[model samples]
Target chain A: MEKKKIRNDIILAVCVLAASLIALAVFLCVRARGSYAVVLIDGKETARYSLSENAEIEIKSENGVNTLKIENGKASVISASCPDGICTAHRAVRYGGEVIVCLPNKLVIRIDSASNGGVDAVS
Target chain B: MKTKNIAFIGLLCSVSLILAYIEALLPPIYAAAPGIKLGLANIMSVFALYKYGAKEAATVCLIRISLSALLFGNPWSLAYSAAGAVLSLAVMILLKLSGKFSPVGVSIAGGVCHNLGQILLAMMVLKTIGLGLYMAVLAITGTIAGVLVGFCASLMLKYLKKV
Candidate 1:
């Protein structure tokens, strides 16, 4: 390998490591929150619920087919009959900076607040 | 190139389009982030990058994305795919010119660029800067996916060189 290749490899390694660290920190923070509010489309807020340490709560819409879970301040589609099921892969979104959206159902779960907002600036 | 070469490229484009469609069918492996794709179509782009150079690679990618969008994507998805394809091509070209990174590195960079472009487009369309927070995680995931895809391409190239 050329000297330049070695240097580039070093740079790439550093970039990857830095990115991993930042992601880990964000994941940790997202996993730390306790209570979360599940906001419905009609502007009605569900009762603020406390998240058991590492516990996941399932949110089911009237449609029943669209069910999601919120755990550790992260929201994800746990189950959905949507053809693609892309929402389910979104998994648990713990960071306030993240969002879980189901376009077909017009559902969006996002962490929004001053504390959650702080996570975005860390990147 | 001759007509035969053009036909070959056409075949590659068709293969890429089919791969894109298949990828569309693959259930998203995650649940929190909808619309995220593993970018299986990138395999063809990597093949073209190694065999035909940057311009051809770009053309193949463009044709694949456009055709895939028309066939299976929504308007918003079309926009995101376009942004991602363009950014990925640009990164691939830059890496090709630098001549320092391997094809694997170039592909990894392409993946990172693709995600960055997609995230940027998403933020714009949603009119929310809040989405920027996901950039870190997206970048990390993109890099990993890119490396995996790149490794696959490298293996394919190694086999091709023997023939």
Candidate 2:
């Protein structure tokens, strides 16, 4: 009985691992390249920048400040005044519907597919 | 519950809190996935569930999450932790009750659910579903962390039973 229980547990763990790997693969393959970076502060749209144009955007919220850098069709938080700096530590993202959020600063940077003749319309 | 049981649960709670404290001290494992951590404290929760059932496990998990949040986290962190802890414990209890999976399997479910719960909360609060990809990243990390925590918990359970 004990051995059977252990076997069941092993099967369960394997299932979880397999499921996660499949999810990761699906996300990676299905993601479309983003054309724009949309910044929101306190759930309000503050700014929108095209990913094609490499630029640095500084966002200031009531809580803190964050510097978002868009270079080479990807967006990343290069710097931040938030205590944790979690946003700054995040990797750059170019996939449509990907996000980098700074909870401390109430800042959110989202990558969006181009609405005008973009991936969303194709799919 | 007996006084001894109450005292033991309190002890388990403190142990879990210490695990949380140590986890906080460690830097984030992957820069690309900011929330990924060892989830070391879950060992205690899984242990409590196997030893004393759902009620004791929930008590230990809640006290640990609440106290750690109060001591080392802000309001936002508290919200995230509370969401994760509640969902994780509930899933662990349900899996345990199913009687097919061992503690390791149950712990794995707990770990994944915990990450899912936190990510769901973040998505709701941020008002965007763009976190879906991030959730995918976390699911993998959470599964790996779950295996480690479950292994340790199962080992601890073996020794504790001999006591």
Give the chain A TM-score for each candidate.
Answer: 0.47, 0.83
DockQ, every prediction: 0.26, 0.59
A1-70, model 1: which lDDT tens digit per residue? 6567646744774697597667767666665442443333322333333333344455555533566565
- Model 1 per-residue lDDT tens digits across residues B15-110: 889989998787664533334467777977987888778888988999998888899986657777899889889988888777898667777788
TM-score, chain B, model 2, is 0.96
Output the worst ten-in-a-row residue range by lDDT, candidate 2 chain B.
B127-136
Docking class of 2: medium
Candidate 2 segments exceeding 4 Å error: A42-44, A115-123
Model 1: what TM-score?
0.71
Off by over 4 Å in 1: A1-14, A26-98, A102-108, A113-123
Best by TM-score: 2
